[model samples]
Target: MKRRALLSSLAAGSVAALAGCNERGNATTGTTTHDDSTRTTTPTTSDAPTPPDTGLADATTAVFETRDRTISLLGGRRRLPSGLVMRAWLSATATADHPARVTATLTNDTEYETTLRLDEVPPFDTTPHASPGRDYDHTLYLAPTERHGFATTVPAVARAESGGWYLDGPPDRWQPEAVELAPGETLVGEFAVVPERPDSFPPGRYAFGYTDDPLTLSAWQSSQPGPTEESAFEDATPPAFAEQSPAWYHDATPETQAFLRPSAERVDAPAAVEFTLHNHRTEPLSGNVYDWTLYKQVEDDWYHIAPWAIPVPLTPLAPGDTHTWTFHAFSGPSVECENAVALGHLGGGRYAFHVNMSSESGPTHAALFDIDAPAVSVTPTEDVSVEREYRLVRASTPDDGGDRATLVVQRTDDADTRLLPEQVMRPRNRGLRNTLPFFEDGVQKVRLRTTDGVVDDALHGGEPERVFRYDGNAFAAWRA
Candidate 1:
């Protein structure tokens, strides 16, 4: 992305040649100053031919006359061949409370529609540097450096002080866009002049100027839209499991199957997987929380899958002791790392959980398993009776200080059932509302189950899931 380019043309002692001539045929000149006192010259009539009348209004008498202080136009407004007028102005005096301001406006005076490609409406200038000194009466005029684009010259009042004014830069994400103006339409922009240094800006006559590319008809017609920006994790790719695993674990030999193994060979996606590790060695085994890495097989290679919780220091397993561990599998990145890929939720695939033992000489162990597709299924049902199976129950009372409601999943059959975590619910075409799991279809029901017939209620506390019932009038919760 091309960030806003700074005003590189405002070098020391570089004067800005004012473009366009006023109605009186007087040309204005913008001189860059660094000294405490700046030299001023009277406006002189030029022999240059008069600029064509494009209905370009005089900014001084037209825009700034209402102000209490006097304001002068440097080169007057520039009227392009297409009748597009560009003008700028600055306040004559400034104080700490009301530092100063620069205003610029663009108007389309032609009968036909006009388009302009403006990266920035009012060009910004570099801060002026000059020490404060005795005030002196000096003439101030808004001058122009470049003809077409934003003005780049700092105002005379800003140049009169040791510390100049500060103006905010463009937003982090900005791009040039086409602005279409109908006949007689206008666009206005203002910049608040603030002192760069904490001290107040010395009171004095001030002038400002604008310089930018000319808004030509060719430039407007040829303008194309810029590329759109993507979010941080939008295009993230999953990282390889072996690349993220510890080098020591990859080099160690596989342990005997009896010491470490998964509870089942296959489990449903987006559900928890369980594993058992036995300390068969004569000594206790110790390791840290991050001693394990979970990987999912993609083709012949394995990619890393992030866990739900942060790793903690592991407790030492005494000889002949057994430890069981459970991990919730879902989609997305849990840990922040460079090139970290976020997998939304686990899909049907082969997976392996590798664990590293505390003993340096101990063999590493890996328990392989297969993740079946999520057991939840959604189908449309015309039967209104099915709606009674789901309800929206108030999870908290008003006295409890929380008025939140929860989705309650009622069992239509006698068989025991389990509801996967909210993260596991994936809607096909629309967003999934966790509290109101019901969708556009009035009787949409989801059947969720795990491989071992064990309910993992760690997240929902073994409570039946609840879903909202949207009636024609409004959404209401019903109890059966």
Candidate 2:
């Protein structure tokens, strides 16, 4: 029989074996029946008849043994179809006033040994909310009667969607490593979650489970002793990027000096900041133009602002070559291009532009600049309520001919709103009579400035006008 078919049969048997087991309190035991004379007897709970002398019985035995060890490590009373036992409970350290620490345990209940291959450092990890792409890829070995546990501390709030279970934050791509669990031995791993508002968290009973299914056949196939070779079940590892010392570039026959700098020391928000890369080396400098990254400095830390897309091919810059790039200040839209790098907007602050030189670990060149607020300002005549959505309009006259303006909407309550650049808008007509949506539920302000600095008074000194305000149920126009 094919390996996949054999695994399917084993999985079915395991599920059948766990049908009547209780999930809450005590461990469940299952007995295996063997017939030596024919070597073809079927498991009591499985619907599929066991074929004679195909090693199905032996594989089933190994799976049962492996599950036994898993149960021992996890203290799991509940059985899973993947031939594993698991349990989740709140730790003693958790309290009503503090974040809850939830722990999940898995045990190996068998007298034999088994191994687990995982995609991450810890064999088991979960996200606070459901995520579709969670997967595993690291290796772990478990001896008979051994157990392993994973614990995470999350907010005390319960999730009705997950049946009152509190999960941890998103998974991190940590370096992978292997671990071993000996018989009757226990290993515990811990992870931390970012705490939510203190008032939002309340004490409650919650369960925990891995984001990815831990009982899949690929998780236990290596540990099963059967005709199938373990190597056949292994996944191919991705190739690692080449790394070189920084001095390698300097030591080259024709030394290359590549540096990035902004066109100006200070740029206005809603405007474009042009960056220039000058290659002052005897040899041609080759690198990917899309490898550039934009970083914003907050206090003492630099946070990376990811680009939407990156061009794939390498670009070669000859001696005395200069390349120019532009990023919209304050998160404005970019001019569309096939090879253009779509960058996020920048707010008023200190920023650095970095570009990779040769390889993944190659040295990077960076330039720094600052952004200042635009000249225009939006002042509200009355208090802006958070529950209402207002529309911004500019009162235009016949005398206002062929003039354009850019309106900037800023949220006063959130400083990080600058990271997202939807606040900038350029009205198309010269009169600037078009209305723009201001639907976000927050205390916000608007600034109106000329598309070009030449039209300074385009949107200012306008007459009283009527605009609509939405209050969840309906929209009402009020004259100001």
For residues 1-480, what per-residue lDDT tens digits would candidate 2 score against the true structure? 243345444433422333233222212112222222111111122321222121111111111121211010111134444334344322212112212222334444444443432332122432322111231122121101101122222112322221222222223322122223333332332222112221222211112234342221111121321212122112322121123123211122222344554556567665566666654432345677777766666565555555434777866544333467766654444455443444323456766666665423345555566677532222221222222335443322222355454444332222221221212222221212222234334424333333332222222234232122222212222122
lDDT of 1: 0.36
Q: After superposition, how far is residue 456 of candidate 1 from its true place, in Å?
A: 33
Top TM-score: which candidate number? 2
What's the lDDT for residue 458 in model 2? 22
lDDT per residue (tens digit) for residues 1-480 in model 1: 011011112111011222241211112123332331211221222211122221222222111111222222233356655578765543222332223334455677788877665543332223312221232222222222222122333222233233333322211211124456667665443333333333333333233323343211000000111112222223323334553332221222233212454556666545566666644332455665356666666555665443444567665554333466666554332233233322334556666777665444555555566667653233222221222344322221122333323223332333222222223332221112222344334543322221111122212234343232222212222221
Give the backbone clash total of model 2.
Answer: 25
Model 2's lDDT to the true fold?
0.33
Give the range of the ten consecutive residues with the poorest summed lDDT in model 1.
216-225
* Model 1 stretches astray by more than 4 angstroms: 1-258, 270-272, 308-314, 328-344, 374-480
Task: For model 1, state the Cα shift of residue 289 in Å.
Answer: 4.3
